[model samples]
Target: MASVAFEEIVETFDFLEDWEDRYRHVIEMGRAMEPLADAFKVPATKVDGCASQVWLMAEIDGTGPEAVYHFKGDSDAMIVRGLIAVLKALYDGRTVAEVLDTDAGAQMARLGLDEHLSSQRSNGLRAMVERVRSQAAGAAEGV
Candidate 1:
């Protein structure tokens, strides 16, 4: 995960000349992802709106304003798993405030996700982002 920094991903995507290459890169990232544990795959964690089954877990690491975040996730689809990798790259190990401030949709857009993804996939991606955003907000509000 440390190797797959968000800025590095952006640069790598920029270097690739074709969507085919980009897709391969994405799939590779997904393949490299650490799988979510069976215990974490609960109904409450399952993401809505995804055409493929997906589970996302977001946890706070500290108290009050100092709280940090960690995320773990999985998806049945390779592309969606790769999309999760993209989210991980952007948000994992960040402070809750940092996670809340991050515009993951805009970040994905910079990678041309809107141009390349299907409508269903796009919606699913949004769902995943909202889930993470909600997690951060909930932590901030002490929910």
Candidate 2:
């Protein structure tokens, strides 16, 4: 199940039938995010496969499978930053097990992202999801 924060976004999306309105809402969400610090934007946090420069930094608390997952991300492109915001809603503050178990594609599909996003954006989104999952899995492994 998605977090209450994410459910709120889903409800907002449902109310905003126009994709353009939804798109603007996404950008606004991105704009609202606390900016990722310049110090954390190094090579290790940088994500591959995105057309734009993207970075994700994870902070895992606790240990093993029960570890809690949290992250901050940034992107050069406004839309991609928005995508990162969407991802944050989807994955942040969950246990590593929950993060690992989330069917991201299915969840994103609920927002009609699969239909509205460009192919490149879709691939970028997948890459971002992979990065989050990898971090969660690593936490689960006590890495």
Tens-digit per-residue lDDT, 2-81, candidate 1: 22489899999999989999988998899899999999999999999899999999878986545888889998899999
TM per prediction = 0.94, 0.98
- lDDT computed for candidate 2: 0.94
What tens digits encode model 2's per-residue C-alpha lDDT throughout 1-143?
Answer: 99878888899999999999999999999898888999999999999999999999999999999999999999989888998999999889999999999999999999999999999999999999999999999999999
Please give the distance, in angstroms, between residue 20's alpha carbon in candidate 2 and its true position after superposition: 0.3
RMSD of each: 2.4, 0.6
Top candidate (TM-score):
2
- Cα deviation of 64 in candidate 2 (Å)? 0.8
Worst 10 residues of 1 by lDDT: 1-10
Deviation in angstroms for 4 in model 1?
8.4
Q: What clash pairs does model 1 have?
A: none
Q: Please state the error at residue 5 of candidate 2 in Å.
A: 0.9
